[model samples]
Target: MALTTDRPITTAGLAAQRQPERNRNVGRTLRRLPGYAAVALLLVVVTYPLIWLFLGSFKTQDEFLNNPTTSLPDSFTNFANYSQAWSSVATYLQNSLLTVLPSLALIIAFGTAAGFALEVLVWKGRQTTLMLFLAGIMIPGQMILLPLFTVYFQLHLTGTLWPLIITYTATGLPLTVFMMATYFRAIPKSVFEAATMDGASIIRSFISIGFPMMRNSVLTIALVQFFFLWNDLLIALTFTTDDAQRTVQVGLLNFTGQFGVVEYGPTFAAICINVLLILAIYIFLNQRVMRGLAAGAVKG
Candidate 1:
């Protein structure tokens, strides 16, 4: 025999039972709306400049003057901006690679190792040394440039690629040490102890255990350092001389002649290409960083 509860509870009874679900849906909908709106606004703000640059690359000075906001070609005339920009841009790009890549490698290698060692290794005055390293972040950029320039002169390294490489690498060390110290410290001490218990020496444990674990943090910071060095014009300008050593920034400045012969087409074209490349790199790495964080949080 089938049985029913009470006097066959009304629709209001069912609604009361599902009240939590309804409240959850309302709360989720309200919270989700603002988050999505924020993301949309941020996208628009970030996109406008890039869109402007890209569209401007296609526009002739006449068209630009006629109507600036229009993105597409007025009549689809052939574009030579990219070609001219490439011809002038590649040389400077190569110079940047030479200076930036080596410096990047040096900074990561030294900084990561230093960070791992400072946090993990048994040593006297470790706290004091770490504190001193952390203090470097407080130093002003310009106050040191003159002394750095003098040192560069004394070493006969000025007007050469080495100066840029060495200076950027060394200058980056402070921040690298600071960040890596924090990340390394976040690692569990027990793991290091286990490695030590396995008869691993100082260098062996660091190489076999510490480095692999810190790979994400290292890559994240290396990219950050690369961006800083890549975009730097002040140090590049101060250290290098002659067209051979001039970076893309100095090269782009050539467009601004004494007269009004601005090469906006080539400049914008070059800039657009770089912006696109940087975007690609950022997207790819950000994905990796996200994945690392998720995996890490889960593992922890």
Candidate 2:
């Protein structure tokens, strides 16, 4: 039926308009259910473990193990375990930061520079160089450990911070170069050409143009690499024999002597502290990195 009139809408017009409302209701119900369910599931997964850790941090050793199935301490207990762990934690953490911070800076600076040079600057045997660089990434970290140890021993470098710092920087290169290369490949070629035409030399072009564009990816890589080196246990354990030079992971790990009498309270507390520390570093730097990425700073 067709009804045409140059008049205001009647009941049929009202019904026609209401039909869209019905469809919208159906569509929204279908969409909202899955979205809410997924959100709920994610919240539980993230919050439960964090809450458990928080609660257990305050409980007594006996209370923690026995009542952990049911609940944590009724009151906060003023975070006493954190102070208890602080004695060893402070020194080891200082050692970790010292090694990790310098290694991280060298990795980012040298690695990004290496990647840019390899990709953009033409020279003899560039392919061979890249392949050789890639060759290291393929070798298992453990396989190189013993040989590296021999070299370190020969250099009289065992039982000190220098060995770990140098080793962390060396191992970090392969992956850092890989990450920088991937991002560099994605930048537009025109930007590099423009910078070159404007008379910006190689170093200036990279600093003024290329490095800005890949900031986000670089920060992400830095975060991942920093945490990787920071949490490393094996290499640090081997190279660090001086009581004061041991990294936090090596020191904390040594706490649990093959017998599983886990200093669970301190362990959980340290875990929480590590999470917060990493989060703080990323949060502070990620904003600036994102801004640099948004500026489209391309690398040659």
Candidate 3:
């Protein structure tokens, strides 16, 4: 036998063997380039209008009219459009705040309690109650608009923010309760049992344990409800005839018409302001909202 030598493969040898596989993966990724390019192009198509609107908000009417497609303004520091927009809708923004804040508070409180009770507590007709709440989601808002208007008119609430608050809270309930209940159901039963063993009442347990655990869900509900209430032009227009009682959505429309000629810069500025407010809230609470949605989808 020729001097037989046994040699073990080193890590380098293994890596060399794997390099072909890595190269193949890289080639596959490259082959999917068209798909990625399509997705990128779709995103640009969808977002271009929003980008244009934002940039247009900064331009003077003459500049915008002259070069409507221009991406940048001559002066980025000019804020007259923003000032004019804010001044026009200041009261409507206040009205929206007044309507949305109290309504959100009530929705959270009631929805949390209702969900916790239905999911965690042992009771008769709980399923039926849940079904009833779920049924509200199926009812088209337009179908109820006439009846709601008539009711509000009878109660002399059509001209005030109270009707808007009540309607928003009521309409928001089905989804809020559904989301909250689904999230609450996902909590382990042992947690509640442990709280009970510690001499905690349902109320105390919910306050101490459930609330913290479901914080993300609550944020999600708040975010959804905020958007719903904020962008509600139809309901605001239907209920609020007075300019003083109008929400920002209605105010923006009225603002556009006030001059008998549309000032694109100021109008776009107002739209941008509204969009920014919602966008800011989304950026802040987005992570929590996603967590809440994921938790809700876990079991129900």
Candidate 4:
């Protein structure tokens, strides 16, 4: 005789037991449907314009003008517009790099140093100095533009790139300093104390230890300032009168004329170039940016 349980083993019984679990899985998926749909819709809304821009970049002037904006180009091999746009914007792009790179370097170096001294060093008036930087953040850039131009004019620096660099550095520094100081404050003081006992100078400790740990914060600041300087039109236009000193943002204006004439193909190509570069950089550094933001959030 075989040993048997009180209930008989049957497919119907097994199916009956599993039915509630299957229903629960279905309910969970149904509950998440709205969020999935929302994300998909948002992605399309953001990506559709970029798709249009890329397609338009390949079109000739005649094709772009005659065809519907939604239509694809007849040829993707057209490089004429890109060649033309590059030639037109090359000088401006060079000037932009010159202005942005130097400005960013100064901002990072000075901001980090100042923040370290304020937050890490035990010095008199440290709090007062931090407060001053905080106050600088509230001052409107527009209010000081006329005065800055006047001073630049007086110093005979109006035509050069120096004014743009100096203005960008100055305007960018306060926020950088504030954020850096905030980051530095969260670091334990005993770490520096131990290094001091080991015969390490403040500069040596900062270089070897302090600054290295700030990689995420520094990257975050760099990206923020990079985008700002890259996209800025007002400051670039105001400070630069000569075409030689104009940045890429201002250079884009050259594609338009007084009579409403536009070079659609080359304009789209130039814009696509900028968009693609920015996207590439963002994608590359996006992980670091996310980590930096998460660190800041948790640290606070």
What TM-score goes with each of the models? 0.84, 0.81, 0.88, 0.93
TM-score ranking from best to worst?
4, 3, 1, 2
Q: Could you tell me the TM-score of candidate 4? A: 0.93
Q: Mind giving the per-residue lDDT tens digits that candidate 2 earns over 1-300?
A: 998778888999999999999999999999899999999999999998888877777776777667745575766865767876677778988999999999999999998888788776678987787888898799788888889889999998887788898989999998888767767767666788888998989999889877776677778778879889988999998888877888888877765423667777777676677667877887888876675454434543
Better of 2 and 4 by lDDT: 4
What's the CA RMSD for each of the models?
3.7, 4.2, 3.3, 2.0
Q: How many clashing residue pairs, candidate 2?
A: 3
Tell me which residue pairs clash in candidate 3.
none
- Top candidate when judged by TM-score against the true structure: 4
lDDT of 3: 0.88
Model 3 misplaced regions, further than 4 Å: 1-23, 66-74, 257-259
Worst ten in a row by lDDT for model 3: 62-71
For model 2, where is the 10-residue window of minimal lDDT? Answer: 291-300
Q: Model 1: per-residue lDDT, tens digit, 1-300?
A: 978575877899999989999999999999899999999999999998888788778776666556656557564443687887888778888888898899999998899888988888879998898888888878877787889889988988887888888888878998998777777877888999998898998788888988898888788888788888888888888887778887776666665424858867667888877777778888889966664444334321
Point out where model 1 deviates above 4 Å.
1-34, 69-71, 75-77, 257-260, 291-300
Please, what's the RMSD in Å of model 3?
Answer: 3.3
Q: What is the lDDT of every predicted structure here? A: 0.80, 0.80, 0.88, 0.91
State each candidate's clash count.
0, 3, 0, 0
